[model samples]
Target: MKVLHVITGLGVGGAEQQLRLLLRHLPARCEVVTLTHPGPVADGLRADGVPVVHLGMTGNRDLSALPRLTRLVRAGRYDLVHTHLYRACLYGRLAARLAGVRAVVATEHSLGETQTEGRPLTAGVRALYLAGERLGSTTVAVSPTVAARLRRWGVPASRIEVVPNGIDLARFRFDPVRRHRTRRRLGLPDDAFVVGGIGRLVPGKRFDVLVRALARLPGDCRLLLVGGGPDEHVLRREARRAGVADRVLLTGERPGLPDGSPGPDLPSLACAMDVLASPSPEEAFGLAAVEGLASGLPVLYAACPALEDLPPHTAPAARRVPCGDEEFGRALAEVRAAGPGPRTAPEAARHYCITRSAARLMDVYATALARQSLSPAPQGVSSA
Candidate 1:
């Protein structure tokens, strides 16, 4: 089948990376469209031979791109249009309908109960989201937590499918050689007890909490905050205020691979660290935590919807702690004392491999296509 994937931006984030990985395993002929900034991921996708189109949408008010996007969809003659993130879902769904595409699907990568990407949910945003959601055949929720949130937001339960985010296991496998090499490259002391947190430096990620926890730990312990964002100054101030500025290491935003590519080398980074800490109070799937586990590092998280949903036997080496500095400090101490929990980290990762996730997604796509075939063509949009 021919499929077109649409996203708000082609940045090195979870959803964008997931799409890049999913296309590798999916049997369908796939292409991509970025409604805004076609960042590094766009280059990586092109390097992988996937055609990517940048719609050059200047801002949220740019409705002029709708006709252009609809034309592209019609010309591609795609069997399905799959949307990811917020802006793409909103516009892609409408464009697909305008192109007379019967099967349109979306993946919800970052939605939570209290806020979305650290912003409060306003009534205007809710109405806009629901309006766009109505144009799609189904929405793929990355975790049970996201699925529940969609339902609470008035999306019919039947239209929501829970497909956990996945990783490429081979790329994330633990390696002693890589560990030493990465640590050396980062200039980390060979004997230091490193605690790492990976994600955008957003308020909701709670990197401040991790900094606080680091201050409470011994001098031998250090914190590595990965990824880049506008909150860098704020977090730096946080580290200084906590009196652990020296112990806090901000790597800015490292490329996913050493080749200057987009994505995350979380596996290698995880190997360099003794433990991984995800103190984010809200997360859809906690991809970083899962990757840390896959890399054979014990993970301490404030919230992990994906890990919590996993069967006990298949769960990774993760411990959920209350969201606070003291609680996280204590949890870190406990984890350091116990050492890396069972060697089941890799085993847990296998259950959420990209290959398995792609297969499940194919099933969802097939079901949506079949349903669309049976129903009369949707009205209000003419075929191009």
Candidate 2:
């Protein structure tokens, strides 16, 4: 079936990247509509041969976006409308209905305990979310933790589907040659213990905690804060304040796509690291930690519902720690003393392979379309 995906923007983030990855794996004929800022991911999607449209939404109050998106949806004649992020969900659902498509689905990719898409859970936000939710047929949560959050927000359990964020395992598979090469290219010392903190440089992500934790670690320990955002300057300032500025590396917004798009890509960076640390106390799914696992790096996370939902035996090296510099600093010291273990992805990493996530999402798609059809479930992406 034909599908159209609507998202707030095509910026480089978990949800944007995940949507691009899913389009690569999902079976349906698909096109994308980004409400604003058709940045790198949109460029990447176009390069990958997906048609994308920029709606040029001015702001949240741009009511004109609704009619424009509706027109695009109608023109596409898509069988289903899949929306991602908050703003897109609000507009995409309304546009899909205006365009006469009933099979609408929105994936909740970043709903923390008290935040949705980095915004505080105000009464107005919750109410608007619920009202827009009614326009969609299904809400896919990236983790059970997020699913629970949605239920608590008054969405019916039956309306929620759990489709975990997935990774491209082959892309993240540890490569000794790449690791050595990447380390040299990035000026990392051979004996230096590299600690990776991968995520947007955001306040809620609490990357500052890692910056401070670096101050307490040995001089040989280096902090590589991957990804970028508004909090980048703040993180750099914190590094300076902590007196570890010389040892901190900030590679701004590398897609790290296994597709060989650019240098210092995520997989190569992953190979160069000895361990991964995520200090963010709020996460719907700790995707970076999983990627770290795929790279065979031990991970220390403040909160990871993705790992918490899984059996502990699946990923023994991944540990949950308190969201404080002192606590995380001790964990890093302990890991460094132990030295690096095997550089091989565990079962937990395999469980979230991109293909598996695609298959599961197809099931959700088929079910949603079936309800609209009032007939046998529609065929979706192949499990193979």
All models: lDDT?
0.85, 0.90
RMSD of each: 1.8, 4.6
Candidate closest to the true structure, highest lDDT: 2
Worst ten in a row by lDDT for model 1? 253-262
Over 4 Å off in model 2, which ranges? 255-264, 374-384
Native-to-model Cα distance after best TM-score fit, residue 54 in candidate 1, in Å? 0.8
* lDDT by residue for model 2 (1-384), tens: 999999999988889988888888999899999999998888888878899999999999999999899889988889999999999999998888778788999999888878988899899998999989888899999999999889988999999999998898988999999999999988999899999988888899999998899999989999988898999999899999999999999999865356634223788899999999999998999999999999999999999998999999999999999999999999999999998899999999999999999999999999999897653222431111
Candidate 1 lDDT for residue 378: 54
Q: Tell me how far the alpha carbon of residue 170 in candidate 1 is from the true structure, in angstroms, after superposition.
A: 1.3
* Residue-level lDDT tens digits of model 1 in 1-384: 999999999876778888888888899999999998888788888888899999999987899989999999999999999999888898899999889897999999999887765657799888999989988999999998899899989999999998888887888777878889998988889888889999888888888998999888889888988787778999999999999999888887655565633376677777888888998878899998888878778888888887888775665467788889999998887777775444335566777888889989999999999988765545666665
lDDT of 1 at 312: 54
